[model samples]
Target: MIKNLLLSLIFLTVLSIAVQAQEALFGAQQIISPEVHDDASVTFRLLAPKAQSVQITGDFLPTVKMETPRGTFDGPGKADLTKDDKGVWTYKSEVLKPELYNYSFIIDGFTTTDPNNPFLIRDVASATNIFIVGGGHADLFKVNDVPHGSVTRRWYDSPGLGMDRRITIYTPPGYENSKDSYPVLYLLHGAGGDEEAWINLGRTSQILDNLIAEGKAKPMIVVMPNGNVIQDGAPGEGSKGFYKPQFMVAKTMDGTYEANFKDIISFVESNYRVKADKSNRAIAGLSMGGYHSLHISNNYPNMFDYVGLFSAAIMPREDATGKIYDNFDGKLKAEMDNGYKLYWIAIGKTDFLYDANKEFRAKLDAMNMPYEYVESEGGHTWRNWRVYLTEFAPKLFNQ
Candidate 1:
């Protein structure tokens, strides 16, 4: 067809322009230059013979992270890269722990990802090169000889948002034929992230698959929903509507996702052979999604029996947040006093919201409410979030 021919021509033209741009910027540079040694040390090489200076920055580097409320994971850490006589920039990192890390290259004060590393994670508004340090404690994120769950892109009608939104669903291996109803974990993403955030960057599917195969985790379904209330879904999904200012807002939509939480839950329960009781339901998220999980658990106590907060952001303006009770502490205490499997919170030592999470933990402790607290060494990055999920998923449905 004429239309198809025109589209193909346009694509070819764009591809040609992009290739030309890349060639102009990085001509004759050996970009894919990461060599991981047996001791977990990695040597990164970048072809930038003409650059004035280059520095490598990642979570593995040592730097003091700011303790302010809005602290970011962008800086406070960097390593000077040395350019060899061959015009290749190189930086050898210290022995890193087994985990995933996001890094970038600073070329003449400009922040850029590793040109050779094709695997990068798209964050709120930026992209970062990612590498996985294998062995030791990070085996959960690794691929193993295990039965893997399938990830499917599906849509559900959101009456509250007045649109059809997409969610990435992960049904455990054998779910297709297994007639047994399975418990579900409603996973949510952070700001500027779509449903693919967890599955791609966090490696939720691999973690779950590995854990389940090891019998460390329960074989259940994971439903990762797009947390943006204003937007129906990510680009290329065909469901995303015209951008609006409200779409930029983090949360608190009168007719947004939280308002229609039940809609997604209902659709999943109805469509999938899932267990329908509260004890069979769990919810967890990171950052903005973590805030939603906390508040949603508060607003509807009986909806989910298991709640997880990963680097949860607790606004200082306390408006029925984790800080204080809706009105009385006794009410929430009594509600929690009832049977619930687990209430877990995890955060890194350098998390900007570490103080807020500690305060929330103290509040929960003061109420004599049982909850688990995990403090790891890292910042507000996918590295910690992925570890939290690996630990959290195993703890679920155990009781």
Candidate 2:
């Protein structure tokens, strides 16, 4: 009886090993969906044998004018994929520039991300597969052989907002071992983004790690706080259960975030080893967050010595009312008088807020406020914002 039991156990173990080997071999045979070639061209593959059609859409492709219920705007251009005998669909694009790009596949008229590709990026509610073309401008966004920084998601009490808020903070490499207190950069995200926006979509940690490793940027602490006033955190992260994220949320552009901005500073100063003075402090953001940074820095003129606005919405909403928005011209003049180290403004020429930025620059010019300006090619996009950040970060605290 003992001999028979041993034989049965041996047979089961051999069967398990054979099954594992077969699974591994099958997994290895799967197609590589996003294959970045040496010439910066990309080949995307999808296995949908039974589907009638396969289409791909991404930012890399030329955009076509799309009509929506609200209005008409440029949307991602779509292209059909060619199918092979094995039921695999494939599409190869011309040479693409060095930047992070996201694409989605449409199988039988249903839009979805690539199943073969594991890397994905979530912008608000929509999620898509992403790939990187390694080369010039995108090199900083890629993680190279460098000492990495630490990113922490911590909760802090916001007495003004009357909630416990979540914040994303990045400490430079060797921060744990070193006893040095570093300067702080309060980096805000655009509308529809939360604390994780900069870290995930913006590639803040990777950029900082690469920049710091190259000695181009200083070793400073970065603090990303949720700019939305009503929400405690990102969608599904707060008390509210998993809910779909929207592009626009209430109290986004209101002065509440700016008014309560001090709470974030207080929390960071109290908890982290950072230089709490104005000279060692900097503030910057994109889109609506840029609007927030502008007002926050102007209202509290003594708080930050460096300010940046990237594709910022320079106009206040008509119904938006608060003390922070009350005396904008006066506050700006006061900010000018106080003298900041670097007041940097950058926007793409084709951005929707270009005119608003132009008007704001005119106001700054009228007041003779010293600020550096940069104009790039593109609309309001993460690509432009990432470039702005890459250029803006090196100029901070240099004086």
Candidate 3:
């Protein structure tokens, strides 16, 4: 009986090993991914013979905001993928419109970046691979045969924060050669965004380059500053720069960023030969940065000639934690009295923040404030933010 039991156990162990070996086989699991065809359709391939299923999720996918009791959000579905005989999964998208789009691969039930794609971008907690659909309005964000500008990572000391902070600066093509002082645009990023956000995710440099080359927008200096109140600089400046836990603990929504706005202006003014009048200085931001721009322009009503809010996220009056002006309407009126150029507010029709923006627009109307309102055709994604910047840039300092 003991001999028979031993033989049976050996047979079972061998069967298990055979099954494991079969499962571990990866026949066709790696290949060239995301090949764009001449007709503007895209084919994506991934090798995962062992995986049971895969799918693709991206902003390029058709977005239909389905209404739910909880709230509204992007599409409830993703593009399904198919597997080939080589164990490689593949997908082909219909001819996409020309625009920068973000996407990721969903293997089984887990979402991940494409291993074969080298270009990727991270916004706060989410990361995805990026691809540009060409030859349409997307041309504005593409690198054309234009005189490109230079982007520099620089630092400045903030007396209010009591530390040196980092900022991304963009100098137009002829900035170095000419002695003429240029107008300055103070661009801010959203929550979970840093100085690099405007440059990396927003593609500000590329947009500026293409716009300036086409003569649709004037050449200027763009100062992209970090809006995080607690951190001294972006992730690479300090010794523990990569330590992101600090970001969560750091309190920014308060009046800290706005109160310290003068420091940034002072640094840029003192260093660069920028046109020093209100007309030459413009401020704009998206989301949290929009909140900052609104507050800063209000607080310093005479500092900037133009203010832009791209899907601005506004908190209810009662929930405002920090020093919001007692009378925002009065403040905005005062700024307009000082001869403002543009008060541009843009938000997508399907944006989650649409209600907040609409309420604010109503307030602006009630106050008889002069502003430009653009209701576009998308959601609260960066795609809208980029479009806002493109539209807003040309209208800046043109007066």
- When sorted by TM-score, best at the front, the candidate numbers are 2, 3, 1
What are the Cα lDDT values of the candidates? 0.80, 0.91, 0.85
Q: Model 2, 157: alpha-carbon shift in Å? A: 0.6
Cα-based lDDT at residue 324, candidate 1: 27
**Taking the tens digit of each residue's C-alpha lDDT, what string does model 2 give over 374-398?**
9999888888898898999998888
Best by lDDT: 2
TM-score of 3: 0.88
How many backbone clashes does every candidate have?
0, 0, 1
Q: Which prediction has more favorable TM-score, 2 or 3? A: 2
Top model number, TM-score: 2
lDDT computed for candidate 2: 0.91
How does each model score on TM-score?
0.84, 0.93, 0.88
| Candidate closer to the true structure by TM-score (higher is better), 1 or 3 | 3
Pairs clashing within candidate 2: none
lDDT of 1 at 270: 87
User: Model 3, range 171-234, lDDT digits (tens) per residue?
Assistant: 9998888898999999998878888889999999999999999899999999999888677676
